[model samples]
Target: MKKALTFLGTMVLTLAIGVTIGQVSQADTPSAPGSADDPIVTKSYVDQKLAGVGSGGNTGGAPTGGSTTDASFKVVTLNPGQTLKGGEGAEFILRGGTATAIASTNGGVSDVTGADDLAQGANVELNHLLLTPRNDGRGLKVGSSTAYVLVRGSYTVQ
Candidate 1:
């Protein structure tokens, strides 16, 4: 008799939980305008709701505003045994000429010749550097120094 009573109690609790879950899910569903039969689960409905959320700073989980500096590139040359120097926040590219030394906090050094020896076409961000060309090579040396030519590049300091 006790075993039969326990089984009956378990069955009743399971049925009650199932019914509660059904009612809660129905309550959470958004109803359609002028109609109770339709639940608003379409993508268009969700997008419309998000579109009206915010503006200027953060809207619908997206950053709506930012600041950027103008882009510019300067043409500078480095001579053999000469050194170019740059400080923190400086950015540049080796557009023309070769280098013996590309010393910076990022790029270690390249004491060679030709375009492949220089960091061409790509931006090189500097923390601090003292670039110098190899003595035997005909290319220029770039580093963070007042004596050498400055190959200042344009970038957004963000």
Candidate 2:
């Protein structure tokens, strides 16, 4: 009886130790880096990746870093009657000259700085942050003179 009791106690203790060791092992295991469970990312890497987002196609003007592929904001000079169309999420800031909003059929450009939506043919406020809601022909139309615009994201000149 005593031996049986000792054996039962040992078995219980062994089972408890096994469970503890299993938990410890699991806790010590490291998750794979940059995975959804880990998600470790450097600040520079994140900035570089974000800089390239939505910056596809023609930039209309020379971009920063002297490379067409650079996604940084560039100064675009538009002549009279020229149209600067923006892609989805594109941003523009008029620095000089007069321009008008080119709204899509569904909506218009969002003037974030002015807290308003610019309808088709509405005058673009200088230095106001204009955000295109979509890629469907939302942009700026140069007025009677040259226009200097700071632009980011995808765009084209027509």
Count of steric clashes across candidates, in order: 14, 0
For residue 12, model 2's alpha carbon misses the true position, in angstroms, by 56
Residue 96 shift from truth in candidate 1, angstroms: 1.8
Kindly report which residue stretches of model 2 are placed more than 4 angstroms away from their true locations once superposed. Answer: 1-71
Taking the tens digit of each residue's C-alpha lDDT, what string does model 1 give over 1-158? 99999999999999999999999999998877656466447667878877766534344443345743333435455544454444333334455444333444345433223223334323233322323332222223533432223343221110
Give TM per candidate.
0.26, 0.56
The whole-model lDDT of each prediction reads 0.44, 0.91
Prediction RMSDs, each to the true structure: 14.1, 11.5
**lDDT, residue 101, candidate 2:** 96
